[model samples]
Target: MSTSRAPPVFLLVLLPFFASTAFISSVNGAAHMTPETSAICPTCPYFLPTPREVTTPEGIPANLTCGVRLLADRKVSWIRRKDLHVLTTGDFTYTTANKFRALHLPGSPYWSLQVEKPTVDDSGIYECQVSTQPKIFRRFTLNVVVPSAAITGTREMFMKAGSDINITCIVKGAIRGAPVTWYHVLPRPPYTEEEVEEINAGGRGGVQVVTDKHAGTSWLLVTHATWRDAGNYTCAPVHATPATVSVHVLDEEVPAGLHHDLHPSEGRSSITSPPCSTLLTVLLLVLQRVAAVNEHGHWCSFCLLLGITSCLSLTAVYTAAGETWTAAQDLSSTWSVWRL
Candidate 1:
């Protein structure tokens, strides 16, 4: 009889346990074989595309960002292209400048170089470099600006009454299409507060404002300017410093640098006419002396001729005073009498 040997009792007892454990192992291995459960292999460091152009105003902080992928065990550095100076390396700054700092978080792919209080000199190309077998870098352009506002002409302007008032303001290094507003501050009494108003186009007053965004210029025009328009005019830009110009309106022509104060209580302005009044007084005293010398009636024609010539000369001087002299009409009447 060819009978097979019987298995051991211990082997038979452990066989089922071994079979269950092998079955469990196979199932777990198959689960891990799936795409979602597989391990990811390390990749070469590379830069991810982000905005490479940055613009910030002076005295403001600027951030230059660099997005990286699979940067395991490699270092990232920031270098200024202008001077070839290394600024930061892997969350640490290499330069001694306090303005430069490296910003990065643990396990984060984004690395940034922070510039505190950036100035115009800091505006240039910067490079974000990665350490690999062959070094790779991405270039970023930084533009720092200083915004300012200024008027094109003199700080103080004089305009005659009934004339047009023209004021131009220019804004530099400001954001494009930034609106510029015009403001007028009326002259006030010595102890009183000033009154301010906004100027607009087609307003109730004859004031008009024209702005050219592309040219970065704003113009204020007031047709038939009057004393009421005399005050401080300000050009305020949304992104720049405000600029001011003083406007002085006169009823007649006046020399530059000459100013007049308005008296609201009197309802009119006053000006001193010393040149014309003093000349007239002196001429009268001289004519009286001439008349006394010719009282005997001798050389009467000569005295009359001398007086007439003197009056004519005085009239010429009075006319040269322009419209500033309020007594011009009175002086003309006196000259007519002397001629008669």
Candidate 2:
């Protein structure tokens, strides 16, 4: 009995395999029953609920971040809500655009989508999705701003001498009242080095800047403008593109199609030629001189010389007054009078 009958050969052969199977089953059951083991087991992937919001200026890089907890072996992806296009997944970019890329560090729970040189068109909502049985997601907002600075009026300005130069600079998409700096670039010789001077408010006589912080506008005023003030004026604002305007200061006459306000001090002096009546009077005087020459033949040479001299003087006056056609007409009439 103690020795028992010799165990069957098949039972002896299968005993080790049965013991191993029972041992494995018991270990697995114990693992499930242990609280510490259950607590340490991997959990389902879920979003950490840390919402991200980003705003970046145009041409700058924008980062949209997403935080996830317990994201074990799950793929994270970024999708643009505007077009529903998949942007990035697990550090790999799906779009053909090179500006977009996914950023993730080793052993980090945060995933970020970076957009280089972002523009205003890139602003919109983005979704960060995690691969799970039901699929979890977190939404984020990205706003791209395009800051700009420009002068209010035309690029080229014609200002008269002794008139005031008033220029306005407006800033858009700025976070707050942007500080503006004015620069003056004087006209220089072709081969000479350019000279740029920084303009300060209240630093010189009749030159000052008025800023409206609330309106994000700055006004540059140069009282009693002269020929020396004619050049290029630039308005540079912080975090915005600079704008320039060319200024031309005329001596007395304003060109045609120019604004009357250019010469505020001298009220609208746009005339370039004398009146028709004055020209007619000059013509009659020349004719009268010719008649005198014809009447007195004794003083022929002296009277003819006087008539020629009077006609030539009138022609010179017409030419100097910017009336070239009138000058030519007067010369023709005088020749006719002399021939008569």
Candidate 3:
């Protein structure tokens, strides 16, 4: 049976391998291995190869291309994580970014996503959706975390004293709602030490938040950003395992303490109280340089940084309603974009 594939459709189909625990797959003797691991199919698993983080070799542009050449009888589609907007399907394309385009290797069994000059706005969980009688699917997280002098969370500013300094937590993996709290690492008299609690003219709860998902890009929104709001903010999700980003909002915009720390574009690092993915995983992969692995036998840093990471070599497992695959991970490094 010649298992090849037609042009791929964007369906936000995620390969369950990466989102879950690390699963090891031994690579066979093949030259064009999309990733370190190949599909365990006698025929073809036309999923794409995705890397957590790739230090583009200088001139090398950023793109997420599935390094496979397979024939899949199923159809594919891509949806926006925010509004569930279908970007591409079969021969149709709908994104405004000209840098974005799909392809099919003639005589080859592979499909890929090509982003021209990927920007921060281009980070999110992209589902490689496949549809069939009883479909088989996979996932890839295209982490377009371009280097920034000030790499903060999604960034949202609000009123301060008059409003609740809402600090939200960014989630990773599958954590829906964990724990959302605020920390004053700066100078605080302690929760009780404050003899005078300034009453905000808002509502009963000074600050309240609304979480969406754990994959889309999000950051805390301080109702009123001010010198008093300057401090460390964190949101811990139900996953509990550790996946949060400490957003340091300064009164005068101080440099992030952990200047060298890398933040994930999607849930690759932190989870929100809930809500956020589809293209490109719609997330970013934070590469932590930990000294050693932990007792759980998992990488220590994944848990330490309040961010948990599971290593997988692209094990295709689609769990969504309508999704499929081609060799892909997530994060567009090979994709090309000229930027506006």
Candidate 1 per-residue C-alpha lDDT over 293-316 given as tens digits, one digit per residue, 9 for 90 to 100:
767545654654565466556656
How many collisions between residues are there in candidate 1? 0
Worst 10 residues of 3 by lDDT: 331-340
lDDT of each: 0.74, 0.72, 0.39
lDDT of 3 at 269: 30
Model 3 agreement with the true structure over 1-340: per-residue lDDT tens digits: 8988854443224444432212223221122323333443223344445452332211224554444334456555655555666666554677776766766555554555666665556666555555532333444455544221121445533233334454444444322333333223332433423222222235333344455654422344455544445444444333223232333333243234322121112223332212111322222221222332325425443442232122111212331212333223322221221010
State TM-scores per candidate. Answer: 0.51, 0.49, 0.28
Cα displacement (Å) at residue 88, model 2: 1.2
Name the best candidate (by lDDT). Answer: 1
Which ranges of candidate 3 are over 4 A from the true structure?
A: 1-61, 67-72, 146-340
Q: What TM-score does candidate 2 get on C-alpha atoms?
A: 0.49
* Tens digit per residue, CA lDDT, model 2, 1-340: 3776898999889765543332123222111113332243335444444546887778877788887766779899999989999999998999999999999998998999999998889999998887754465777888888777889989999987899999999988664666888999875544557688998864568999888867879899999987667779998877778899999888755443332334444442453554433444455566567767676654655654665566567667756655554556655665565465
Q: Sorted by TM-score, highest first, which candidate order results?
A: 1, 2, 3
lDDT of 1: 0.74
True-vs-predicted CA distance for residue 143, candidate 2, Å:
2.8
